[model samples]
Target: MNRIYLPLAASLVLIVSLALVEGKMRDRWGTPGVEAAELGKRFDQVPKKIGDWVGEDLPVEEVTRKTAGAVNYVSRLYTNSKNRNTVNLWLIIGHSRDVCRHTPTVCYPSQGFRQTGDPLKHHIDVLGEEPAEFFTATFSKEDPSGRHLERVFWAWNHPNTDIWEAPDNARVHYGLSRALYKLYFVGNVLNDENTIDSSASVDFAKLMLPALNAALFPEKIADTVQSDIQPAGDAPAEEVPAE
Candidate 1:
C-alpha cells in the first residue's frame, strides 16, 4: 500500500508542476506595459508582415539602467526583475510613470524574456494600438568589461501563441529571438556583456538574417559541429573593433 501510494503521489507532483508552468505561460500573452486589453486586439490580428506591425515611434521617457551583463533601455515606471544575475536588467525609456507617453493612459507594449527558464512563456506589455508608432529600440551593453554586448529589440504583443506554431513570418521574428538567445548563452561562456552600436546592429543582424529571411527555416540547431569558435591556447583577448 505504501509503495503504491508513493507512485500516485509522485504522479500528482508532476501534474502540479506542469500546471503551474502552463498557467504562467497563459498569463503572459503579450508585452506587459499599460495597454493590455487593447494590445490584445491588434496582436490577435494574425500578422501580415514585420513592417505591417512595428510601424512608427511615439514619445517615451528614454531611461537607461545597467545590470551585471545586460542593460535595459526602458520607461521609468514600467519594469522590474527578480533574477540574481539579472544585474540592473531594465532601462526605463519613458517618463510620467508610463513606457508609452502618447497614449497618456495606456502603457506601451514591450515583449521578450519568457519566464526566466521557460522559453515558451511570453509576457505581453502594451500601451496602445492604432496610431501606434512601434519602433525597435535596442539597448547596448552598459558595462564593457565582463560582458558580450548584444542588442535586444522590444515591442508589445501577446505571448500566448507559440511562435513555433505561427506562420513563416513568426519564425522570422523568432529567428531574431533565437539570435538573442544565442548571444546570451555565448556571453555567459565568455563572461562578458554583449554590446552593439544602436545604428550598426545591422552588422551582427546578419548572424541570423538567413533564417529570418528564409521562407522555410531549418529546424535543426545551428553550428552543431565544434569548429574554429574554440580557442586553441591561452592568448591575448580578441578585441573586436566597432562595426
Candidate 2:
C-alpha cells in the first residue's frame, strides 16, 4: 500500500511540474504586441515583383489551407524574366505549434515523395543584415509521367526580430512566441542537379530577402538608412583648395 501511493504521488508531482514550466514559457514567448490576424495582413504587402523574378499567386485548396493550420498564408510562383526558371514560394504565419509540425519532411512523404538525403543547413546572405539560415532538402516522386524532383529550403522567424533560423525543433524553439512565420522556397530540379547553391530558389531568396524585410517589418526599414550620410557635427571639415 505504501509503495503504490508513493509512485502515484511522484507521477502527479512530475505532471504538475511539467504543466507549470509550459505555462511560464507561454507567458514569456506568447505575448507579442501585434495579434496574429494583423500580422497576417502584412503578407499581402510582400511584393509580387522582386528583382528579376515576377510572381503570380497560386491557388491553395481550402482543405489544404485549413490542414496547414495557418492563420494566413501566401502561395505563389515567381518566374525569372531572363532564364524562365521558376520557383514556388510558400509563406505562412500562425501559432508555432501549428506551423512547425507540418514541414516538407512530413508533408512530402505523405504525398508520395521520398527523401533523397539528409537535409542540409544553408545560409543566405541578406544585405544590411545577418546571414539568414535555412534547411534544404531534396525529394523525388515517381508517377506514370516520370520522376519529379524538388528542392525545398525552409526557415522560421519571429515578427519582432525578423531573424530567420532553421532550428532542429521549431515547435519547441518557438513554443513561447505569440505567432511565428515560416517560409519556403521550392524549385524543380532539372537534369539531376547536384548542387543547390546555384538553384533558382537560392538566387531568388537573395533578392527577396530585402523586399520581405521591407514589407513585414516596415518600421524597422524606416529606422535603417541606406546611405552613409552623417549627422551635421559628425562630418569632417572639407579641405580648402590650394591656390
Candidate 3:
C-alpha cells in the first residue's frame, strides 16, 4: 500500500508540473500587442508597379477571408509588360497560429490539387540586404477546364524585425508574435521539367523585395550602398613646385 501510494503521488506531481510549464509558455509567447489596422494600411502601400510587372487587384470573398483569419490581405495578379508572363501575389497579416496552419501542403490537397513533389527551400538575394528564404512547391489538378499546374513560393515575416523566414515549423517559431505576415508568390507552371530559376515568380520576387522593404519598413530604410568615397584623413599635401 505504501509503494502504490508513493507512485501515484509522484505521477500526479509530474502532471501538475507539466501544466504549469505550459501555462507559463503560453503567457510569454501567446499574446503581443499588434495593431491590425495600421498593418492593413501598410499592406496597401506596396506598389502596384514593381519594375516591369504591373498589378491589378483580385477580389477575395469575405467568407474566405474570415476562414483564413486574415486581419488584412492583398490578392493581386501581376503581369510582366515585356513577356506577358504573370504571377499572383497573396500577402496577409493575422495571428501567427491561424496564418501558419494554412500552408500549401495542407490547403492544396484539400482543393483536389496533388503535390508534384516535396517542397524545397529556395533563397532569393534581396538587393542591399540579406537574402530571403522561401518554400517552393508545385501542384496540379485535372478538371473539365483542363489540367492546371501551379508553382508557389511562400514565407513568413515578423512585423518587428521585418525579416522573412521560412521555418520548418512556423507556428512554433512565430507563436510568440501576436500577428504575423505570410506572403505567397504563385505562377502557372508551363513545364514541369523546366527549372524554376527563370520562372516569372522568381524574377518578380527579386524585383519586388526592395519595394516591399520600403513599404513595410519605411522607418528602417537606409542607403546601404556606398558610392565613390575618399578615405577619411587630412587632405593630401598640395603639389609643390619642388623637384
Q: Which one wins on lDDT?
A: 2
Worst 10 residues of 2 by lDDT: 25-34
- Tens digit per residue, CA lDDT, model 3, 1-243: 999999999999999888876654344444432455467679878989988899999999998787676888999999999988899999888767678889989989999999999999999889878999899999999999999999999999987888888999888898755577889999997653378777779889999987887887777664332223445675597888967
Clashing pairs counted in every model: 52, 1, 0
Q: Sort every candidate by TM-score, greatest first.
A: 2, 3, 1
In TM-score terms, candidate 2 sits at 0.81
Task: Please list the residue runs of candidate 3 whose C-alpha ends up more than 4 Å from where it truly belongs after superposition.
Answer: 1-34, 222-243
Residue-level lDDT of model 1, residues 57-131, one tens digit each, is 223332412211111221211111222121111222111112222220111123221212211211222222122
Those runs of model 1 whose alpha carbons end farther than 4 Å from true positions after fitting are 28-243
Judged by whole-model lDDT over C-alpha atoms, candidate 1 comes out at 0.26
Winner on lDDT (1 vs 3): 3
Model 3 steric clash pairs: none
Error of 1 at 62 (Å): 27
**Between candidates 1 and 2, the lDDT winner:** 2
Please give the distance, in angstroms, between residue 30's alpha carbon in candidate 2 and its true position after superposition. Answer: 9.8
